[model samples]
Target: MSALVDMNAKSGNLERALKLFEEMPKRVYRLSKFSGCSIATLLKVCKTTEHLHHLHARIIRKGLEQDQFLIAEFITLSNSLASLNYSSSVFDRVISPNIFLWNSLIRGYCQKRCFQDVLSVFIRLKRQACLPDNYTFPSLIKACSSLCNVEGGKSIHGSVVRHGFEACVFVGTSLIDMYGKCGHIDDARKVFDEMTERNVVSWTAMVVGYVTVGDVVEAKKLFDAMPQRNVASWNAMIQGFVKLGDLSSARGIFDSMPEKNVVSFTTMIDGYAKSGDMVSARFLFDQSLDKDLVAWSALISGYVQNGQPNAALNFFLEMESMNVKPDEFILVSLMSACSQLGSLELAQWIDSYVSKSSINIQQDHVIAALVDMNAKSGNMERALKWFEEMPKRDLVSYCSMIQGLSIHGQGAEAIRLFNRMLTEGLVPDEVAFTIILTACSHAGLVDEGWHYFRSMKHKFCISPSPDHYACMVDLLSRSGHVKAAHDLIKSMPVEPHAGAWGALLGACKLYSDSDLAEIVANRLFELEPRNAANYVLLSNIYAAAERWIDVSLVRNKMRERGVRKIPGCSQI
Candidate 1:
């Protein structure tokens, strides 16, 4: 009977094995090491815990629980399911775990992103007098990459050399990847150079490394030099072009691919949308015959990002009619669209769906999106309701709260939250400072604005970007110090964007300073020739100053440039 079970299980007839086990008297079956190993193999194919438990019990009943091979197999299966705790429990049961067992446990922990645990396991592996292998170094180095511990990874690189596997092609590829992910591109380059044998994976890893560091020029150069190219290498190049916003290059390669996968089309769609070419984006979407969930998500997200939120929502409805299950990306995209439309009813519907979602959107992320949706839709009270109920808060939650408060003219409240963020040790990033600065500027709190502005560089070490400078200019200008704002623009280390000059021009219009407005307008025109707002702002300033002749000249320039004001939009 045990032989029959082993034969059936080994032959991939698990159902027959299971039926045979059930039909036999439980105590009558005497299973051997091979039969136990066969059941363990069957455990690999079992998806449900119920069958797994039955097999586990059968193994113990047959007194084969101490089979080292079977135990190792159990550990591998646990990790494959991402149940690292189960792997650990199985490892604890191993009376004499060899190097292979240690490596398996470490690899599983690495997959869980428990980098510290991976290191701890490595230390334990060494203490057990088991020499780490080439397989071991790759997993350990990956953990170092995940932790961004280049120093630790370099030390592991030393171990690879000590073990005489430094020149090994597979280990070399893993090293290049690890260094690249850890932000050590130079180190990655050094390894790539010394390798006497380079495969497609090694070259691709180098390309991806350059891409990850925002050095697309280097990535492209390396990509062009590869002796042979695989689809993955081509995809890496496509990704590099997308990151560089060279949509033309990305599309060119995408067009030339011998074969296209779902990832290829989705990346192109996302690239076009990011570059603000919605027409091209939709053309690609309509052409895709196999619109997988990710492809659908890319199109849907593109519409919302390009500000056609209503169109995005309508298309989502169409997707639903096709029975395509919505993922978290689609749900979040819908939330943003509903928020932009300020349809509280729709936002409310999404909230219900979130609670019932089988996909398990992280609690904090879902709550943050809900809060942002409500806040953007002009439902501050409801926004507060979800925000206050959040179990925890992250950077996005804080940013959305401050931005929502600023947009609603709750400047005081926004500043209060910012101070609270500081008190809680939540170091504000660039976006956080921009939101608070805009809030202070909007509220006309010049003194507080100046304090925060100076603190941005002096205290926070955040060098003010153009957006921050614009907020400061607007703040000073709004407070009746147009001259100070102009001087500040002159003092800017970086070139002022149109927003800064536009703010200064608006202030000049308020004070009827046509002379200063004329100077600023010319710069604005030169900086952003096609921006109608600048032309309109300059004309308005001239009119306020009773400079009809200057206003006429501005109108002529707008006509020559064929610039027209965008139609106004009002939230219903």
Candidate 2:
């Protein structure tokens, strides 16, 4: 019976082993001798924490807890509890844990993102004279990587080499992942190159490392050079291409693959959706043979991203009709869709379902989505209600409320919210400033816009991006200050983009300033010659000033360039 249990445990057939253990006749010597491995296997088979506790009590009643092997097994079970971030009662009960027990706890803490606790436990283990083995460094490195602690990671790397496990494949892979995550891509590459043998995981680690750092070109180059490609390798490359906004290239690769798995399909669908090519995504969705939860989530997210919130909601209904349970990710996507479509009724229904179902929607992303939805639905009162209800508030939630207020022309309210964000000790980011600047621009608050733009660099230490410059130009131009706007453009530290030039041109037409209008037209033509609107703008300016000859000359240039202006019309 003991041998059968051992074999079943090794083979991961815990159910059959547990049944046999229950049916075995009660024998004192047999229970004493086999209780350690039996409890270990039972714990492995146990689906719930209650079952694990019950088995632990049985082990103690049989005096198996005193056995060194049983004690190690108990520590392993405690580590499992830590994996779920549950109570530490099992850890408290362990008498004198071995090196394996200490390593298990460290690994569990690392997995739970308790990096500081992992380090403290490591210190305690060293004080107890339990020298860390090969298993020790991987979890330690993983903790450092999660914490972005470069110095701690390097110290662990030194310890790895000292222990003669630097060449171990698992250790090397963890080191590569650690360095890459810590922004030491060059060091990761060095480790990859120096390793004599490389597996799929090693290659995937490097590829994903480059992808994480936004080095898509390098990721693609390495991906193509790989001798073998697995599902993860393909998924990594597809995800990398998606990040670069090269959905066409991602599709090309997806189409060329010998096997079209669920992940590949989902990645391509998401890529198309992100690029605003929902037509292609829906076509693929219809043709897919196997649709899983991830595929549904990706499609729903795509709809939300493309501003078709109604379609996203309809799909969510379809997903439920098909008996697919909605996870937190799906709920978040659905909530965002509700917000985009301004479907307050649907948002309320989702909120109610979240509470009743006890779904773990505790993430800031979900809370922010709810806030944004309420704001979009023109329910600022409800939006604030949800905002205040969040267990933990992050920058995204603050930005969402600010954006909602700005969009509704409540510039003062938006600024007030921004002030509140500052009062809460949360530093504003580029998006936060962008929202405030937009509110100022829409409210015709030119001075406020300027102050915020300057504060972006001086107060927040964030450099003014092109979006900020564009907003400032709109604020200046809309106030009938075309020449001032032009001078601001000229004084800009960076070259003005097409959007900035276009904003100035629109203002020129509004104020009928022929001199500045002509300058803006010329700049627009230089930037985008194929834009028929530029020639049309110049012709209109000529006609308005009664310069028939100049207008005729502009029309001739338009004819020669094969530029045809799109006809303006109103639907309603």
Off by over 4 Å in 2: 1-64, 81-261, 264-290, 303-317, 334-362, 388-399, 418-434, 446-562, 570-572
Model 2 TM-score relative to the real fold: 0.68
Best by lDDT: 1
Ten residues in a row with the worst lDDT in model 1?
Answer: 25-34
Itemize residue pairs with steric clashes in candidate 2. Answer: none
- 10 residues in a row with least lDDT, candidate 2: 81-90
**Which candidate achieves the best TM-score against the true structure?**
1
Q: Judged by lDDT against the true structure, how good is candidate 1?
A: 0.84
Cα lDDT of model 2 by residue, 269-383, tens digit: 8778777888898888888999878888888988988889888989999988988888888988988888777766776787777666656666777777778888877778888
Models 1 onward score TM values of 0.72, 0.68
